[model samples]
Target: MDNSTLVKPFKSINRWHMLGWLLVAQVMVAFIGRSLAPLGVLIGQDLALTKAQIGMLPAALFLGQSIASIPAGFIVDRIGSKRLLLYLSFGLGGAFMLMAISSNYFFVLLMVAIGGVGYGTMHPTSNKGILHWFQQKRGTAMGIKQMGVTLGSALSALLLLPLAAAWGWRMALLAACALLMATGVLAYRFYRDPPSAEPHEPERKISWSYLKESIGAMFRHKPLVLLSIAAMGLSGSQLILNTYIVLFAYEQLGLSLLLAGMLLVISEVSGSFGRVAWGIISDTIFKGQRLIVLVYIAALSIGIALMVTQLPEGISFWAIASVVAVFGFCISGFNGIWMNAATELVPFKQAGIASGFTLMVGSWGVIIGPPLFGYIVDLSGDFNYGWFFLSFVLLFVIVLLLWAKRLANKETQHNKGV
Candidate 1:
C-alpha cells in the first residue's frame, strides 16, 4: 500500500502529525477550563462573593460566550478559526497573568471575564478543524477530540488543585497563563482553518437579506431547533451533577476530601473513555440516528436519578463511586452526539456557523444550570434537591425530543407527498 494514499489533514496539519496536534490543542483548552473550576470556592472567599456572585463565575463565562458566539462564528466563517484562536489564546493567557496581579476582586473578575471571550473560541475552532478534515468519520474524530476536555478536567485534579493548595490560587492563575501562551504558540504554528476546496468563495456581501435568510433557515430547521432546546436541558442536568457531586460525596455522604477527589478523578477518567465509546457507538451502532440524542438524554436522566435516589444509604462508598462513573458515562455521551447532529443540519459551507449557533443555544444551560440547582439546594436545604431538579430538567428534554420526532415525521410526510 502506498503511504501517499493515506488520509490528509486539511491544511496546516497535512502530515500525520496533525492528529497529534489537534488532540494537543483540545487537551490544552479543556485543562484550562477544568482547572479554573476548583478555584471557585477560593475565589469566593478572596473576593467576598455571595452565593449569587459565586454563581456568577460560570454565568460570566456563558454570558461572554453568548455575546461572542455570533462574532466568533462570523469570524470563523469569514476569516477562519485559526486567527480567532490565535487572538483568543494570547488574550486569555494575558488575562490570566493580569488575574495573578490584581488586588481587587472586581478587577480580577473583569480579567476572568475577558478570558471567557477567549474560552468561547475553543469549541468552534476545534469543531471546525476536526469536522472539516475528517468528514466521513466525524464522530470518531470529535470523540477523540472531546476526550481532551475530559482528560483535561481529570488533569486539573492533579495539576491545578495541588498547585493552588501549595502556592495560592493567584499563582495557579499565572501557571495557567503560561500554559495558554504555550498553546497559542503551538496552535499558531500547527493549526489551520479546516481547508476546503472552497474557503473564499463569492457570495452576496453580508446584507439584511442574507441575515434574515440564515436566521429563518435555522429557525425553520425542525430537528436542529429541537436539538438546540434539548441541548440546553441535558446540559443543565450535567451541571446539577457536576456542581454538587463533590459535596454530595463529602459533606452529604461523609467521604473525605481525598476520597471525593479520587471519585471525581474516576468520573473524569471514565468520561474520557465514555466520550470515545459513545462516539464509536454513534457511528456504528446508532447508524447516525437522530434519535440517539434522546436515548442518551433518557439514560442520563435515569442514571443521575439512581445515584440521587439510592446511593446515599443503600450503596457503599465504592458503589457510590460506581454510580457516579455510570452517570458520567451516560451524560457525557451527549457532547459528541449533539455536535454530530448539528453537523448534519447544513451543507459543509455553513456547517461552522450552524454548529456555532446551536452550541451557543445549548450553552444557555451552562449559564442556567448551576444557579437553578443551587437555588433548589437553598430552598430545600439539601443537595438531593439538586438531583431531583436535574430529573425534571431531563423531563423537559424528553418533551423536546418528542416534539422533534413529530417534526421529523412531518418533514418526512411532506417530502413523501411531493
Candidate 2:
C-alpha cells in the first residue's frame, strides 16, 4: 500500500499508535542505559571497583553493540524489529535485575555484556520502523525517534542517582528492568512491519545470489560510505562529550562531584528535546536539503565552545547545564537525519542494512574517542583541550555535510519521478 492508503486506516483511532508508542518504548530502553552513568561512581565505591574496572562496564556494552550491529540488522530483516528489540530489552532488564543482587565484578560485567548484546538490536530496528511507517517525514520522524537515546540517558541521570540513593543501586537496576519489560509487552501486542512494495527489495531471495549482490552493492555504494564517514566525525565529537564531560566539570571546571553529575544529566536531557526539535526543523525549517547536517554540526560546535570557554570565574550549574544540553542535543539530534538519508541514497534493497553499517562505523568513534579525550585531559591538565578536539572533529563533519547535500540533491533530481 502507498502512503495515502496507509494513512487512511489510522485516521480514526490511533489510541496507541504503534509507531509513536514504539518510539516511546525505545526511549525508555535508552533511558535505562543513560541512567547508568551516574551509578559509575556509586558502583565503584560500593563494589570496590578501580578506575580501569569501572571503565570496563561502558566498554562491555560498546563491544557487544559493535559486535552485534551488522548481524542485528540482518536478523531484523528476517525476524522483525519489534521482536528483536523485545528480546534485547528483556535481556538487559533481566541483566540489570541480576546486577542489583550481585557485587562480583566479573558477574556484573557478564550480566551487562549479555544485556549489551540484547540492547544492540535497538538502533537499526527503531530507525527501520520510522523508514517503513513515516516515509515522507523520515528525517523528522527519525529525529524524534532518535531522541529516545538522549532523553533516556538524561532521565536516567536525573532520576537514577536520587532513586539509587533512596533505595540502592540494585533497586534502581531492577526498576529499569521492569520498565523495559513493560515496553516489550506493548511492542509484542501492537507493532507490525509494513509490507514492502517489492517483497524482496532485489526481487529474488533464498540464495547466495542475494548475498553476493548485497556485498557487491555495498562496496559500490559511495554515498553511504561518505555518509558513514560524516557520521563517524559526528560520533567522535559526541563520544568525547558523553565520556569526558563529567570528569571535565569536576577536574577542570572545579565543580563538586554532585554539581558536575547534574550537569552531565542536564546535557543528556537537553539532547532528547534537541533531537525532536532539530529533526522537526530540519525538513520544515531547513527545507529538507543536505544543509540540515551542517545546521546540526554548527549547533554542536557552539555548544562545545560554550563548555570550553572557561574563564577564571566559576560557571553556574545551570549555565553549564544549558551549554551541555545544547551540545548533547546537537550531538544526538542528527542521528535520525542520517538514518533517513540512507534510505534514499542506497539502492532500496540495501537501505535496511544501512543502519548496521553506519552504526558500526560511527561506534568506532565512541569506542576510541572517549579514551582519547581522557588522554588529552591527562596530558593538558585541563579539559579545554578535549573540547578543542571535538571542535576539530566538527569541522570535518561540515565538509561531509556539504558533500552529502550535493549528493542528496543530485539523487533527488535524478529520481524525481521513479
lDDT of each: 0.68, 0.69
lDDT of 2 at 408: 65
| Residue range 1-418, candidate 1, lDDT tens digits | 3322332433335623555566776677666655545555566667665444555566666666577656675677667656766687787678767877877767766776777777767777766667556647776677677667777777776677667767887888788778877877887887665445133455547788886788678877878888898889877666555545654676677775455656666777766666568777877877777555556656665666855665553346787887888777777556767777777755677776678678768888878887677666767877776677678778778888778767776776888899
* Candidate 1 pairs with clashing backbones: none
**Which runs of model 2 end up more than 4 angstroms from their true locations?**
1-24, 44-56, 70-86, 100-107, 123-147, 182-206, 254-259, 277-287, 295-303, 306-313, 347-350, 353-355, 378-381, 399-418
1-418 in candidate 2: lDDT tens per residue?
Answer: 4666865665563423656766787777777665546677677678986544655676677777787666776787777766766787787788777877898989988887777776777877887777666647666677577667766776776777777767877787788789888888888777766644334357445577876776567556666777778777777666566656665676566777667778777767666666557657767867665356545655557556645656333677777777777777778566667676666577776776666567666777666666566566567766677667677777777777677777767876878867
Candidate 1 Cα lDDT to native: 0.68
**Best candidate, lDDT:** 2
Indicate the worst ten consecutive residues by lDDT in candidate 2: 195-204
Number of the top candidate by TM-score? 1
After superposition on all C-alphas, the RMSD of every candidate to the true structure, in Å, is: 4.9, 5.7
Separate clash counts for every candidate: 0, 2
